[model samples]
Structure formats: structure tokens, C-alpha cells
Target: MSKRPYSAANPSPDKTAKATVDAVKDITISEKASDEKKDDESKKDEKKDDKEVSNFVMPNYLDGSFHWSYERLASAALIPLISTQVIYGAHPVLDGVLGLVLPLHLHIGFDSCITDYFPARNYPRANKYMAWGLKATSAAVIWGCFEFNTNDVGITELIQRTLTA
Candidate 1:
């Protein structure tokens, strides 16, 4: 066996022996503390489960269900928009509609993702900031699309040229 390092705290052989015993006691105490912590967490989860069903409130017209319908409608609208572009080729009106619809669709999809990942219940501040940021970005995107359609060759023509090139 290797010689044990002497410390000022454990000066004598008896004290050194006592220190080893204390170390063993500490390990058991730490294990018990961890077990207690786990039990507390489980209790919290049980309480959460018990209180899962909350009292119903009056449905606000501006809730997620309202937005969910809009999301579906936007998605449905895209199929016809895309089909028209592919079948009839590009038109200024079609490009304008596509520009508006596509960004709105993308914004709604990303908003849903942000709401799912950064939920207001868990991350209130982050969720609020993210929602605001998404709004600002979506506004900017719509503006840029409007400028492109008006000032440039428009979205559908750009895509057609890009793909052909």
C-alpha cells in the first residue's frame, strides 16, 4: 500500500482513522439528501398532475383556436397559389398574392414553433421577446416582398428565372 499523506486537520493516527469514518458517513448523508430531493421533485410532479385540469374561462375570440383556423386557411390557400404559378406561368397579380401568402404562411409556421419551444408558462420573458421579434421580422419580410414585387421583376418571375438559370 502507498503511504497516506498527512494533513494538519488529521494530525494523529487516531484522528486519521476518524477522518476516514467521517468521509464514509458523508457519502451516505449525501446519498440521502439526493434521495430526498428526488422525492420532492416527484411530489411536485404529482401535484402538477392533480391540478392539470383548470377552471374554464370564457373563450377569447383572439385565442389559439382562432389562429389555428387562420393557419389552416393559409396552408390551403398555398396549394392553389402554387398550382396557378406552375400551370399558368407568372402574372403580376399572382406574384403579389404569392408574396403576401407565402410570408404569412412562413410567419405563422415559425410562430407556432416558437410558441411550442418557448412556451409562455415556462419562459415568459423569452416567449414574449420571441413573439415580438417574429412580428417585427414578418413585417419586414412583407414590406420587402411588396417592394420587390413593385420595384423589381416580382417573386414568381425571380423564381422562374433562378430555376431556369
Candidate 2:
């Protein structure tokens, strides 16, 4: 029997091998392009999510505003606090102001610490009531200290005597 000459219809082993390699290279290139497209899409999605998060505002549950301005005022009050403490017994007015303000400052600082650790998001109703109760208690304490300063031997004097003794 005579062997048929290789034609377009019947590729030789060499041609078939080259065709297979070329097909694989094309498939690999296409797959790499698709992967790069997917990566670009994911990066765009991440940027969108980041923008949304930045624009989002946390809902306020409290009745009144705790403005950033108040925080600045609280920070400024620290100067007087340190000055009064150092002087200890400069004047009756300073002692009385210290008596009221010191407790308030302490309460605000403590409440902030508590709020940071035990956020309102965790227990909405409980957190609101807890914060209100803390504020009420702080007010009462401040009032009592102020009264004590007015009625008794000023707060600084009392503390100094106690510390010395």
C-alpha cells in the first residue's frame, strides 16, 4: 500500500505539535487578560466601598449634641485645673470653681472612657440611659462639692489638711 502525502486535510506530526503549542499560548494569553480585568474590577469596587464608608455618618441617639467645640472647651479647662491644683489655696473663688469643675472634668473623662470601651452601638437603650444617669450623678456630685466649698473650709484647704495629716 502507498502512504498518502501530507495535505491540509491531514496535518503531519510536526504541524500538529506546532498547532497545539500555539493554541495553548493563545489560551494562556486570554486567561491572563481575563485575570487582569478581574483585578481591576476588584480594585474599583474597593475604592467605591472606601468612599461610601468615609461619607457615612453615624446616627445620633443622644437627646442633645456633644459638639466638638465642647471638647475644645474641656481641653482648655485643663489649664485652670493644673494651675489651681498647684496653687492649692490661692483664693476662695478659685477653690470653689475648682470644686465644681474638677468633679465635672473627672466625670466627663471617666464617661468618655466608658463610652469608648462600651459603645452605644452594642446596647443602644442601655447605653443612653447609662450615659444620662452618669451625667445626672456627676451634676449631683458637682453641686455637693460646690456646696461643701461654700459651707465648709474650701475644697483645697480641706484636701491639703487631709494630705498633711
Candidate 3:
């Protein structure tokens, strides 16, 4: 039987080696191109992030040390205020003080939640107006509570009766 010079069953070692080298070179070139694209994409993403951060504006009330301190103090004061109302039972003075602090606390806490969910950036005028409305409503509520406490069973007692009954 005569042997073939270049058959599929008897492939040359040099040809196989050359093919393998070419495939490797092609793979390396593609990988280099992909890596450069990834680097460019990452740089673009970083620039977008920097622009967003620079443009971001925190609310004025949230930015100040005095507001932070006041919020902290109000939160701390609630513990004692609640404890006194619970243990000693509600007095006129306690009810009056609670009326002042509690409504403000509720307004601030709810307004903060509203601010977080519905940011000023999305609703600039609405956010400001909403906050003002909250403050005004809270003030009115406090005033109403004060009037009720002076005229009737008081705020805590009224809550107790409502719950029990």
C-alpha cells in the first residue's frame, strides 16, 4: 500500500503547531481589545458617578449641626416624656408639654420619611410646600390637643378611654 503525503488521518505536526499558535494569537488579541473596552467603560461609569455626586444637594435642615442636635435631644426627651405619662399618669402640665413635643416629633419623623421617599430633586417645590404643610398641620394639632386638655379628659386619658372602650 502507498502512503499519502498529506492525509486527514496522518496530519503534519508542523501544520498542527502553526494552527494552535494562530488560534492563541487570535484569542490574545480579542482579550486585549475586550480589556481596553472594559477599562473605557469603567472610566465612563466613574465620570457619571462623579457628576451625580457633585450635582447632589442635601436639604438645608438635614445639613446643619443645630438641627441634628435638636433632633437627637427631641428623641432622647421622648423616652422620659413617655415614661412619665405612663407611670405617673397624665397631668395638665405633662399633657401640655407632650402636646408641644409629640406633634413636632411626629411631624419631623414623618417629614423625614417623606423626604427620603419623595426627594426634593424629584419634587422641588412640592417637597418644600409639603414640609411647610406638615409643620403647619402639626402646630394646629398641638394647639387642638392643648385646647382639649384644658377643656376635657386630656390627651392621654382620652387615648386610654378610646382604647379600653
Off by over 4 Å in 3: 1-60
Candidate 3 to truth, TM = 0.58
Candidate number that wins on TM-score, 2 or 3: 3
Model 3: per-residue Cα lDDT over 29-51, one tens digit each: 99999999999999999999999
User: Which one wins by lDDT: 1 or 2?
Assistant: 1
Candidate 2's TM-score? 0.53
| RMSD of each predicted structure | 11.6, 7.2, 8.1
* Candidates 1 and 3, the one with greater lDDT: 1
> Any residue pairs clashing in model 1, and if so which?
none
Largest TM-score belongs to which candidate?
1
Q: Per-residue alpha-carbon lDDT of model 1 for 5-57, expressed as tens digits?
A: 77896487988789899999999999999999999999999898778756566
Error of 1 at 62 (Å): 7.1
Instruction: Decide which is better by TM-score, 1 or 3.
Output: 1
Roughly what TM-score does model 1 have, to 2 decimal places? 0.62
Residue 23 displacement in candidate 2 (angstroms): 25
Residue 83 lDDT in model 1? 92
lDDT of 2 by residue, 19-91 (tens): 9999999999999999999999999999999999889676463432563445557778768775766675546
Clash pairs, candidate 3, are none
Tell me the lDDT of model 2 at 42: 96
